[model samples]
Target: MSENNRYTLITGGTEGIGLELSRLFAKDKHNLIIVARNKERLEKVKKEVEKEFNIVARILSIDLSVNNSCEEIYRFVEKNNFVVDNLINNAGIGSFGSFHELDMEKEEKLIEINIRSLTKLTNYFLKKMIDEKTGGILNVASTAAFLAGPKMNIYYASKAYVLSLTEAIHEEVKDYGIRVSCLCPGAVQTAFQNKAGIMKNDKTKGLMMSPKEVARIAYRDFKKGKVIIIPGFKNKLLVLGNKLASRSLGRKIVMHSNKSK
Candidate 1:
């Protein structure tokens, strides 16, 4: 429980929001164990972060979509005797298109990464934190979690699960001196948009926040023990609007936004 021994473990930390969160944590003098799929990027991030932050940065190069990936990570850190004070379940993927026509293989992989791995990893680390009686967890969901996304069905549903699970866990573990938070940012300018084939219309472009800003707000609010952290005013408004509207209307709004020009 000493400062030197505490580490924040982040998944998909080589790029995008995960990378930004890694930087923020490092800047605050938190040691990091960053996991990602690319070896080169991992090495680069490790070197840069350690040099810039004057803190230890460990790297793990493994794809989270594969089976047993979360267990592998747990074993890796346990073998090294790293104490993960905070667990950031930031690794997730998305696919675009109608549900029926989308590739089932990719959809399954998405679920594995976004849902199964996150769940397993949290279960592994959260137990340790509970025993220790101090820790934090930040699960990155999306504003899309508030409504049904037409073209991006599976991805939205997966995030909804994240939001719901994190909320319930926050209540469950608050008495244990552990903090659990759900980050629900709207449109972030990151590689995820391209990978998800999210064609930003004029409206989405206007709503988009940089990864740096989103990560800044997320880390700040997470430290405050905010259960649901929505990064921007527009995103908060969007979620509120969704809550105020009927489920059918919310679905139509998302479907219209997803339509290609």
Candidate 2:
């Protein structure tokens, strides 16, 4: 596909790694469609991207946590005649306390957004890309995916699913010339900490990385079709350690770190 005809569609693109990825894509002169629940922030980002890269930036404001969100997004894309060349399933949520302690509604919303919606959107776009014979997919998982997190159980499980799903799809679509990458970033510095209610502990802050650095690494690794892209050296070691450590030991470490604050 010609560069002019291709456009990237990024979810949760108003902030964090998603926003940084949008900026990177814009720098490469690719048209962009950024989806987020915040219309105002999305508009602001669109303007900034257009100003900086001289590329078209389309905004779609919709809550991915809603049950029917995937269908709604699909319909909107069909109605607007937007063809996506790259799909970034970056929207997700996390709960900080014990799963049972959190409100049931909040827990369900987290699952809907982080798992169901991501899967639906990937399936939707993957079909289209397969038919077109060219495209890419990047799903944002987390280092939490490598182990069972005690305090953030549901979020960790959801990301584990993302990593598994992305890897499976990567193998399935390799022959279609479509690259699929799962990004497993550790403790990124963004609104995620506040949203996830992660305690303001020294360990968390010390391990935190800038969203721009994570995005840059993810984008580079993704383009090269890396199956799993962990952004930092520390994170890479953590992932490797998870593989070598006993499952019980890994879970204990996660629980300790989470409760340190």
| Model 1 lDDT tens row, 106-177 | 999999999999999999999999999999999999998888989999999999999999999999999999
Per-residue lDDT of model 2, residues 66-156, tens digit only: 7787888788778878788899999888888886688889889999999998899999999999999999999999999999999999989
Which TM-score value belongs to model 2? 0.96
Q: Give the TM-score of candidate 1.
A: 0.96
Off by over 4 Å in 2: 1-5
RMSD of each: 1.9, 1.9
Question: Candidate 1, overall lDDT?
Answer: 0.91
Best-matching candidate per lDDT? 1
Whole-model lDDT per candidate: 0.91, 0.90
